[model samples]
Target: MTPVPPSRADRSSPGEVLRAGPLEIHATARQAFVNGARITLGSRAFDLLLMLAEAAGRVVSHDEIQARVWPNRHVSETNLRVQVSTLRRALGEARHVVSTVPDRGYAFTPFGQHAPEPDDAPVPGDHVVHVVDDEADMRDALEGLLMASGWRVRTYGSVGAFQEALTAQTAGCLILDVSLPGENGLELQRRLLALGLSLPIVFLSGRSNIPIAVEAMKAGAIEFLTKPAAGEDILAAVARAMALALSERPQSPA
Candidate 1:
């Protein structure tokens, strides 16, 4: 298998191997092990485990896991639950390393930290993602990818729809088409800023010249990705944007 490049989304070198307690984590090769026994992990499962290990003793919110593991993909929690269950079973009682925080999210305790005192906090809503694209295929593909990686995705086929969605719900990040049906993406971004919403925006299109990319960046796009970008790259940008949004939010974990 090809090694996934290192990104903040993935917490390892391109082909580095990791040994933590009885478990071994080889992020480059996408493999895991416990006590010299090989543990089978799918790409998604490996990504989740890597996120937990990176946190390594802190409780990783559901949104954080979704952003890091799935990136620009959108998926329902059912899939996430199945994968987590499988991982927990594979790890068995060794899963003390991966602790569920009631309605909040999962935490990685590593092998050393003692169990944390219970904290009663409200379980936040599912992570929110916004996709603005006039092309149905592209929108659906991106939404499907995000869902598979684990997030709640909303799609807008027009600027009006995008604006309505923005006002109706909260979004961790925005995936915007550079050319919209009514107004250009740069214009839309200006409007977003005018409204005082600093949501992270990512631009995508089939026409991403250096000039256009530079203009979009100046208009506040965190990244300008071409249409049909690699899944990993798209995810990396999305994860970075989400982390930024999460940091900006004032919600304190109870």
Candidate 2:
């Protein structure tokens, strides 16, 4: 039998708090705790947990899970499975709380349900990694790779597309292709500087042009790499960019 998707009331609002076994979930704050100790969860994992826990004891179908978690984005089964694995790992010994419901989907079985102790951990900011490449295949590949690594990702086909979607409040690093159809990566970098946007950029070029690479570095690019860069190298560059971006981000007032 097909499971019914949770309605608005059935879904947990960001302001609501949920407790199941040793898990204490703060939907509003986007946080979770086990046995009063806060646990680190990727953004997607946290969202999945809230959805399942809100619909506790009920099966959330694969379609519903993908829609709720990825929203308008189309993701592969592997993405969902990877996120589930990540969430389960974060749950530790209480991983059984999230159970696979045969071929239907998954359910949160409120095992050993109990009240949660008070917790006061500050919430961490959520960041996304943006990838801009003219090649559709490249964009998809990079998105999957980064998402699998637990980083939220957004991809664009060109500088115009990226600029259209960018805003002052946008956070995270950018993986940019050097030779774009319009504006090009270096031009965009210059424009961003003129506009005072401090988004960290990691440039990828099909050709190894020393002059262009040096210019990008002088303009404050976190890393510049020739195309077909190793996955480990890309990941490392992104990690450094994220660290720089987060450090520059203004902290919220207490």
Candidate 3:
């Protein structure tokens, strides 16, 4: 990867600010302030906005956006456009900083004045990580690992527990064990997809082999890890999955 050049929004520099309610976003952190409350952005959106802000006052091509946002597998340009559109709507009509670059790509052009506070609390959109494993020890371990890595972790021992939790809170990524007491992990994944609940999925299978992993991946698993996997590998895969999930999450109106 090439080194990122210094920008006006750098830690030491001052750039145009974006204010949503009480949220004041500096170049760093991409923090959102609402009614004196701080809102956290998911990792992927934070990185994406930072890259766009750093390229403020200039046009960033679609290829550049894809290279920065998704460094993994190839993604379509439409995906990048959708994300940009979502970001714009989230920013509301206060000022349209993100502008289209016609056929080439997009550019940042700040407009409009900051508005007064709205009456309602801003709906939170932080990335959440969910773990589902039958073993108590493994469930606790994964939760601890994900929390230490700065993710909001939720754990479940069975599919019933997971389903109940999903009713309360949505997750950005799912770490699922293939074999569960009630519904198998793969079966659960299939169900989630059928119900239109699509999040990045990582499968952990004691029986994970070429065929099993391939089947899981074909069934929409992002990555499959066999039992006795190293912690770092799991963390990396989770991070990647979280990033993908963040960009894919359905956005509410601004």
Candidate 4:
């Protein structure tokens, strides 16, 4: 494991401001400016910039970046890369200030600059969505829909497969079908609760099973939809689930 750096609050005063060429970062206010004009940056992008800027000339490893920007979430390298690209775009001409160190991580070179872009910045997705359904067609369809709507999606054909892939740090929403060959969706939900994993879930059933739906909702499922659910409805449910997941993330220390 890469050694974790000191918290940002530990190294800087509340109102401290950092400068990199023409860019200015207001730490307390969590805002950035370029040439005296404010720029639009997403929360994650801003966090990434702050971490890199504070570290300045040091190479902040991928692990450190993920720990600071995502806190407890288990995010892929692609997520970090995307945020870096976002930060670079926000920085405009000064984008070269943020450089990727080969096989290591990223660094904020205040003096030097480079022009290597991140490889094929994956679809502009914010979070991963894990889909578990026994039907191959359903899994593929959901994956396509979610990916098209800017979500990183992974599909599994069985509960076992999903469980095998899951870890304590897995951070995302789950779209699970209620029926399976064994260890059904409801059982998996119960097991997850017992294991203390609070991953927000959206339940899908081929038939409208009111009792199962009630059970799932009672157990804290974000949404329970019966197929053939409309595409819009599924997307809406996923959005809600993603929101819930975001809300449940542990906040970083101030």
Candidate 1: regions farther than 4 A off: 1-126, 252-254
Mark the regions of model 3 whose C-alpha exceeds 4 Å error after superposition: 1-126
lDDT of each: 0.69, 0.75, 0.64, 0.76
Model 1 lDDT on a 0 to 1 scale: 0.69
Please report the TM-score between candidate 2 and the true structure: 0.52
Cα lDDT of model 2 by residue, 52-150, tens digit: 888856778889988898888886654564456446657875665776543467787666432121132222355788999999998998898898887
* Candidate 4 weakest ten by summed lDDT: 1-10
Q: Judged by lDDT relative to the true structure, which candidate is superior, 3 or 4?
A: 4
Off by over 4 Å in 2: 1-126
lDDT of 3 by residue, 1-254 (tens): 13232223334435545443333566544564435455456666656666665664456777787788788867665455445534543554321455554345665544332111113232235567789999999998898888897778888899889898674247588999998997999889888988788678888888636666656677767667777766765775676577566556667699
RMSD of each: 13.8, 18.5, 14.2, 15.1
In angstroms, how far off is 249's CA in candidate 3? 2.0
Worst 10 residues of 2 by lDDT: 114-123
TM-score of each: 0.51, 0.52, 0.51, 0.51
